[model samples]
Target: MSPSVTDHVVGRALSWADIPRLVELEGRLFADDAWSAPTWWAELAARPRRDYVALESDGELVGYAGLDLAGEVADVMTIAVAPEAQGRGLGGELLALMASRAREAGAAYLLLEVRDDNAGAKALYARAGFEVVTVRRRYYQPGDVDALVMRLRLRDERDGVGDTNG
Candidate 1:
C-alpha cells in the first residue's frame, strides 16, 4: 500500500534537552542496539557536521533522524519512527528533510545502511530513489544481520542535476 502524509507530524531540530526522551524512545524502538545517552550527547557535540531532527505529533515526540556530512558526502546516521507512527510517511518526510539539508550543505550524495531483514525500511529507501551499493556481512551485532548499504545522488542545487556518482 502507498504511504500517506502525516499532517500532524512536525519536524524540528533536536537539542540536548531532548536527549532523555530520545533515549527512552530509542530503547523502545531499538532494544539491542539502542544508542546510549552519552552517544547522543557526543553526536550533538559535532555541531554543523552532524545534524539531528526530531519529529513531533501533538507536542509528543514520535520520530527522529540524524545526518553526518563530510565534504560532498552525507550519511544518514539514524532514523526511526514510533511504532504507532510507522507507515504514515514520517520516515520519508524525515529522510527528505535530511536530503534537503545535505544538499544545502553541498553534499552530492547521501548514504545509509539498513539491516537486510528490515524490508520496510529497505522499501522506504527504495521508494525514495536510493539504490543498494553493497552489503556488509554480519554488520548488525548480536543477530548477525547483513547491512545493505544504499546511496542516493542528491540533485545539485545550482544545476538542478543529479550528481554523476553511482
Candidate 2:
C-alpha cells in the first residue's frame, strides 16, 4: 500500500550516522551497481558541495538522495525509495529537495541519468520537467542497460528566475 500525505514521513539532511542504512538500502535496490560503504564515505566527505537527504517513517529510513553541485550545474547522483514505499510520492519529494538544495547553492540546472529500462523513473522525471538531453550506451554493468541523461533547467534563462520554491 502507498503512504498518504498524512503518513508519518520525515525528511532531513543525511548524515554520517545514516550511511550504514543507506548502503544497505542501496545494495537492496541496485544490486548490480550498488555503491560500496567506502564510496559513500567519500561522498559524505565532500560535504556541502555534495548534498544528500534522507527520508524516514516511524524511525526507519525509507528513502535517500544525493546531488553533486558543480558551478551552475547540479547532477543528481542517486535517488532511491524502499520498494514498499515506491508509489507514495517519496521519490518526487526527494527530487524536489535535491533541486531546492542545488538552487540554493547557485545551480542553474539539475541533471540526472536513469536506466533506459526504468519506465517509472523516466515518467517521474518527465513529469518533473526533465527533458532527455542525451543517451549513454551500455551505462549500467551486468545488465548493460543504456542510460537516459535528463536535464531540468532550474532557472529561466531569460529572466534568471530561479527555483527557489522547489
Model 2 per-residue lDDT at 35:
86
What would the per-residue lDDT of candidate 2 be over residues 99-159, giving only the tens digit for each residue?
8888878889999999999898999899888999999999988788999999988887888
Clashes of 1: 0
Off by over 4 Å in 2: 1-11, 163-165
Compared with the true structure, all predictions reach lDDT values of 0.86, 0.85
- lDDT value, residue 101 of candidate 1: 84
Model 1 residue runs over 4 Å out of place are 1-9, 156-166
Supply the TM-score for candidate 2: 0.91
Candidate number of the best TM-score: 2
Error of 2 at 79 (Å): 0.4
What's the TM-score of each model vs. the native? 0.89, 0.91
